[model samples]
Target: MPSSGSYAMVLDSTFSTERRACRFSRILIDGGSSINILYRDTMEKLGIKQGQLQPSRTVFHGIVPGLSCSPIGKVKIDVMFGDKNHFHREPIWFEVVDLDSPYHALLGRPALAKFMEVPHYAYLKMKMPGPKGIITIAGDYQKSLTCAAASSQLDESLFIAEEKRLLDRVVAMASKQSDMPTDPKSAETQGSFQAAKETKKIALDQADPKRFAVVGSHLDNR
Candidate 1:
């Protein structure tokens, strides 16, 4: 992989639905992936009802180093490939995940092995056996690279979501720390709030020096 420029190619193609009415584009055939992932949006677009998806508790990682993804469910989608002259339909089980990606579906090792397909990255082609003969899926390099460039947006979205969760946790912890503790010894170890452990009473109005409420001394008079 080149570090500086966007000069990478992939076996990106499209898969047709069982009805052959709709085709899901921006599909990536990745041999490196261990599980086939179907984007939630794509599943919906395919008219796959929620009732069709079976309960799945499988959690997987690798897209993001520190993040793990738990798919909503899994379903077997009849994927139609090749042309009218020689087409093949295969039922592939895909884990439905809620992720923002340029690709609609990711055909992993499981799917590749299921189809007994061979992918040639250099030529941007995928060959698999069909009823009549061998089916070849050609990838458009320019379109693939365009989609690949937008692929990083998914990672950025993931990172943004993760950061929000972390920030929410910190806010919750801060609220916990601000609460009054039953015992002084049991108070949480506070770090950088800069809040005074003890409060003092200050005059609110100079006309009536007694008009005051017990508040943190660090609080602004305004």
Candidate 2:
């Protein structure tokens, strides 16, 4: 087993869009991902116009099985790293997705390859070749933990919202059924009404478990 200090660290960095500079507290430099991704909200906040986005067919899959996300579009933005003297700038293509993550963006394998950088997670740093020399980016352990917690909370909220939406739909359907006229004296009408109630209950029970499973799987992957 590794020592406590030897744990892997989450790396973060500051980047700017065309409009303004932004500091992303939660950036996951993932070597596993083939392409870099930017959250839709972040792109919008950076004043990127919807017309600038080009349609894309790229799909993103999480660690969870059967869970996949599709990007809304793709855009090219200039990304800069390092301090005043040693900073490097490059135009990077990013897939914009509607992801409710704590991270504003994810720098993936492509970005890593572009920078020709090697990440040393144990040391909480990454180094890349620069014009002058090697440039180093450090990770913050405390900030990573805080961001992880916040991301978890956000996931929970989204799950709850989805559940509430399903429940509301079910309730609406029941209310519509109740509004329909039914002759209480007719035995056939009574039987049909009772059957409808049972059907509604069964539908609610079955649909809820599936939806909950999907949400749980997505959360587990994150």
Best model number under lDDT: 1
lDDT of 2 by residue, 65-161 (tens): 3357888899887776687889766777999887777778888888888888798876668899888898898887776667668766876776687
Model 1 residue 118 CA deviation in Å: 0.6
Poorly placed runs, candidate 2 (over 4 Å): 1-12, 17-20, 63-67, 167-222
Q: Model 2, residue 171: displacement in angstroms?
A: 5.7
At residue 149, candidate 1 shows an lDDT of 69
**C-alpha TM-score for every candidate:** 0.72, 0.67
Clashes of each: 0, 0
Candidate 1 per-residue lDDT over residues 60-137, each given as its tens digit: 997566789899899888776676677767788899988777878888999898888988777677899998889988
